[model samples]
Target: MASKQDTAAQGTPVSGGTASQHTTPPKPSADAEDAAKDKKPGTVSIDQDVEDKDHQLPPHPEPLPPQHPSFIHCMPPKNPAITKNKHSVFLAGSIEMGNAVQWQPHMVKRLHHLPITVCNPRRGHWNTSIIPAKDDMDFKTQVEWELKALDDVTVVCFFFDHNTRSPVTMLELGLLAEKHKVVVCCDKRFWKSGNIHIVCGKYGIPYCETFEGLVGLIMKELKKNDLDVDENGKLLSEPSSAD
Candidate 1:
């Protein structure tokens, strides 16, 4: 049998009784205890679940895919599909053929995260020779599609480009002003800025001078009506009792 001094030197607990006797494990060192306490809170270890009961922390949510807004344009002779969305925006702005800036693409990019449909009037292939006559089937179809989309959408965003006259845009604004579903962005450089300003003021319509400001106003309107969505395309707020 080994001497008690030999057993102690080998770091084994010594027992005077039979070998069947059990020995208690040694306590952890002070340094080890302090190190454990110093560990960052909420740091999940391999042995611990992400949602540890002792920590009372929720599991980290997985990242959601990017959300893109649906777009509808006047062409291919289709009905206003924008009505399929919970909310829609009619891009009633300056599209003076080859003259006005292509602002629709920029607007669409900015509103990509929202769960709303964007109805664009600019045709993909416009025939300049097509006469705007009542008998012209193509012209009639385009006008009818725009009219229906304007009526079906929740908001009408009107942008008066400084480069073009935008007579049609002005007319559309007048038609929707009384309905109180229009927002205007009139560039100060626009020839008819004064008239647009006066009309917007008269109807108490929200109007802005910059493109960014226009987007902000539209977001505000959507949030006010609970029609806006989160980054994951989920509705930001629950529908009101009236809705």
Candidate 2:
């Protein structure tokens, strides 16, 4: 009964209206749908929460193997045969009784992986009360043992601890300086570092300021003598001859 224009103006459905006469709601965008999926209970997408497997970190590597111990020869009373084929190092340094640091054990540990012998003069059971005189047989024997070991070893390694005077070490340095087989390491704080440095420079001996540097210099000397090895104690391969 209502006119068509009046029915449309009053917001009422027109009589026998076609489907095309009404508006259709828009479809959700792809991004909105994805966001809705991620918001679902117990559901998480890679972009929203989970990290991609391709970008994940790698597993840790295995640790290196343990090193082998070197042959060590301590000073007199307990005579052990020296390894003839292996190179030897004589630890001649600050042994100011209770005053000096026990550096020999550390040095021996550093060179443990190498095929070498270490001549350690610091006795495990030294008679500290013995008078250091020619008349004292014990003193004479100890001094004689050091002298022979210093003379026989492949290299003489010296470390001047800053805490002690080490006059005997200085004397030993002077004795071996001209031999070109000596390597010296002196703490910068040592009282006589200047004198040691000058002597090393004059004799063309390798001088370093730290214990580790002394070890490196010793390795270099060994390498020069055909005992080739890397810093990690791995033996270096010999270069093949050209046909």
Candidate 3:
């Protein structure tokens, strides 16, 4: 029987401290269920306590490519006789001497696409007669025409065959060696191979064994000069390199 004033003076457990102090709310019913689920086998979340791995992943690599092929003939352009600003090349080689076939036509066919005027003597007028007669008009005309070409041309190509005695070809070489640019290709079996090689050596001209070699040298020279001549001596729309 404490007096009201005395009771007020003494501090009482304002709330039910002793009973509730150590007590937690009965975990919400679902909380036990959640814990039970977590304890259940294989209950992992993709986004659990695991770390974000995008930044830790090793980088992905790139991929690769393929391969290609090669060439046979240094082929010329499809069309050659089409331009005005073209160079000139004279085919000064064996006619009826060694191979029995004239190479001028073949040379023209190969080089026709180039910006060049090919002066082929084989195309010039001639007869069944072996030698040109000093008095024959057609022979004289042919001779004069060829001689004039030598004077006017930019390059002279000398090809010697082994079968025939091409004395005139030799003379043409000597005459034009100093005056014009000359490319000499002499067959080893030519009667005057030694003499011709000596002359080419003296003049510092390109001397080759095969006709194909001669063409290669000419193309090289053209490339060096940066002339319109293509890699194969054709005037191509898109200048390409030899393969």
Candidate 4:
């Protein structure tokens, strides 16, 4: 048997010899030592493998939102009236067949709801006399009144029923359209197929068969204008791309 000191010396592994190889823990460098000394005692030191694994994960990006279209705001609280450049509608029809009694008042009411001034010279029976008289003075007077009504309106809403409309109403329409008012010719006649309807169609004027329908059509056109008038009754006209 070898002596105790000789056995111990022989058991130690040399550079060229193989024994039970034990790896020594890596020593801290001068900078690492300084960093370790400055750090808190329980601070975790991440290995290169751990750092690389953390960086390897794909980044989660923030989600994006979808896009949408804009809409017009509805009528405002105590909505202002339309501008002076707005087209006023003239209710033209007959006194009989209860056209004035039933429709004119309702039409006028609707106009009040809008930013428009409705002019109906034939609000009573007196104005209807012009339809039959055909007298030069009477016709001239009617013409002047009709023209005066059209002076401020950018458009005309003419209401004529087969039972009520006469030659005078026709003449009134001609003057309004000639003055370039956007003519809205409506007929609530129970029996329509007449010369008046043909004339309205030829002139390219829009007409509705019922009062409610007519109101809807007129409102649609007014919305296109998007105009606003001042509180002092000063009218401001906005440019409209739609006719």
Identify the candidate with maximal lDDT. 2
lDDT of each: 0.57, 0.59, 0.48, 0.39
Question: How high is the lDDT of residue 215 in model 4?
Answer: 46
What is the Cα-based lDDT of residue 77 in candidate 3? 16
Error of 4 at 1 (Å): 99
Q: Pick the candidate with the highest TM-score.
A: 2
lDDT of 1 by residue, 1-243 (tens): 111211111111122221222222123223223434644544322111121112111111234234443433322245666645666788888876634555564465455556677777754445555688989987898888889888988888888777679999999989888876778777666799888878887877887665544665666566655765542234565443222
- Model 1 ranges with Cα > 4 A deviation: 1-65, 69-76, 228-243
What range of 10 consecutive residues in model 2 has the weakest lDDT sum? 2-11
Each prediction's TM-score against the native? 0.65, 0.67, 0.57, 0.46
Order of all candidates by TM-score, from best down to worst?
Answer: 2, 1, 3, 4
Tens digit of lDDT per residue, candidate 2, span 1-243? Answer: 111211111111113211122111122223334445545444322122222122111111123223344445454544423444357788899867534555665566556556666777665434545788999998898888888888877788888877779999999999998996788777556899888877877778877665545666677666666676775445565422212
Clashing pairs in 1: none
Q: Which ranges in model 4 have alpha carbons more than 4 Å from their true place?
A: 1-87, 96-100, 123-142, 177-180, 183-192, 228-243
How far residue 90's Cα lies from its native spot in candidate 2, in Å, is 0.5
The alpha-carbon lDDT assigned to residue 112 of candidate 1 equals: 52
Q: Candidate 3 residues 1-243, lDDT tens each?
A: 101110000111011111111111112122223434544343322111212121111111111011112111111111222122334567787765223334444444444445445666643222345356788775676677778766755567776655657788998998876653677667566788888877776767767655555554556555554555544444444334422
- In lDDT terms, how accurate is model 4? 0.39
Screening candidate 2 with a backbone cut-off below 3 angstroms (N, C-alpha, C), the clashing residue pairs are: none
lDDT of 4 by residue, 1-243 (tens): 101111111112112111122222223223334444554543433201111111111111112111111111111111212233244555565434232223444444334434454555542212233353446675566556666655644455655544543555566666655443443434334244355455556665555443344444455444444534332112355434323
